[model samples]
Target: MDCIANLASEKAVVIFSKSLCCMSHAITRLFQEQGVSPMVHELDQHPRGKEIEMALKRLGCTPAVPAVFIGGKFLGTANSVMTAHINGSLNKMLKDAGALWL
Candidate 1:
C-alpha cells in the first residue's frame, strides 16, 4: 500500500493492472487516446501481486486490476475512469496531474 502510494506520488498517472484483464487494456487505451502516458504496473507479474490486490481492495478499488491514480490520488474503478472521460472531466484531471501538456 505504501509502495503504491509512493508510486502514485512519483508518476503523473499509474494504472495498477493484470496483464490479461480487458479492463486494464481499456484503461490504458483511454489515457493514450487522451494523449497521456500512463505508467502500468501489471500486478500479476509482480512478486507481491496478491498483496497488492488486497491493498487495493482496502483502498476501495474493486476487481483489483486497472485501479487508477492521478496526481497522487485514487481515481476509482474502471467505470469511474470511463465516466470521467465521458463527462469531459478526465482531461482536466490529466491536465491537473501534469500528465497532459496540451
Candidate 2:
C-alpha cells in the first residue's frame, strides 16, 4: 500500500511493529544493539493500525507485526531477520541500506 511504502521509504530501516509484541521488541533491540536507529511504527498505536495490519496480511505477512523494510524494500518477518543476523548478513544489509556506517 502507498501508506506503508511512504512510511518505509522515510527511513533506511523501518519496522512495522506492535508495542506489545515480543518479537517486535526483539527486532528493535537487535537493530539498536547493532547501532542502527531504525524508524519503528507501532501499529497497535497508530490510528490506521487495523488497516495497515490488513495490508501487511495481504502482502503475505502472517503475523503482520514486526514486518521489516530496508531501503524501502520489504524484508521478511522475525524468522528471516534472525536468520540474516545469524548468518552475519544483517550488518551488510544495514550498511547497504545506509542504516549503518560500519
Candidate 3:
C-alpha cells in the first residue's frame, strides 16, 4: 500500500500489470506510442502482491491485471484505459495527472 501510495503521489502515471497479459500489452503499447513512460509494477513478481490486492479491494475494483492510476486516482482496468484512449480522454487525463507537460 505504501509503495503504491508513493508511486501514485510521486509519479504522474503508474500501471500495474502481470506478465503476458494481452490487455497489459495493449495499454503499454498505447502509452509508449504516446511517449509516456509509465511506472510499471509487475504484480506477478512483486512480493507484496497481497498489498495490491488489498488496495484494489479498497478501491472497490475487481482484482484484475493492468490496473492504472493517474495523479493518485484509480483509473480502472485495461479495458477502461483503452476506452479512454479511443475517446481521446487519456491524453487529457495524463496531462491532469501531471504525467505530460503538454
Query: Model 1: per-residue lDDT, tens digit, 1-102?
Result: 898798668789999999999999989998988888898889999898888899999998878878999999999889989999999999899999899988
RMSD (Cα, Å) for all candidates, in order, is 0.9, 0.7, 1.8
Q: Model 3, which residues run further than 4 Å from truth? A: 1-3
Q: Model 3 over residues 13-102: C-alpha lDDT tens digits?
A: 788887777778778778888888888887778898767867866776565668888888889887788889899999999988777777
Residue 74's lDDT within candidate 1 is 95
Give the top-scoring candidate (TM-score).
Answer: 2
Report the C-alpha displacement of residue 35, candidate 3, in angstroms: 0.7
Pairing residues by index, what is the TM-score of model 1? 0.95
Task: Extract clashing residue pairs from model 1.
Answer: none
Candidate 3 similarity to native, TM-score = 0.83
Instruction: Give Cα-based local distance difference scores for all models.
Output: 0.89, 0.93, 0.79
The lDDT ranking, best first, is: 2, 1, 3
**Best candidate per lDDT, number?**
2
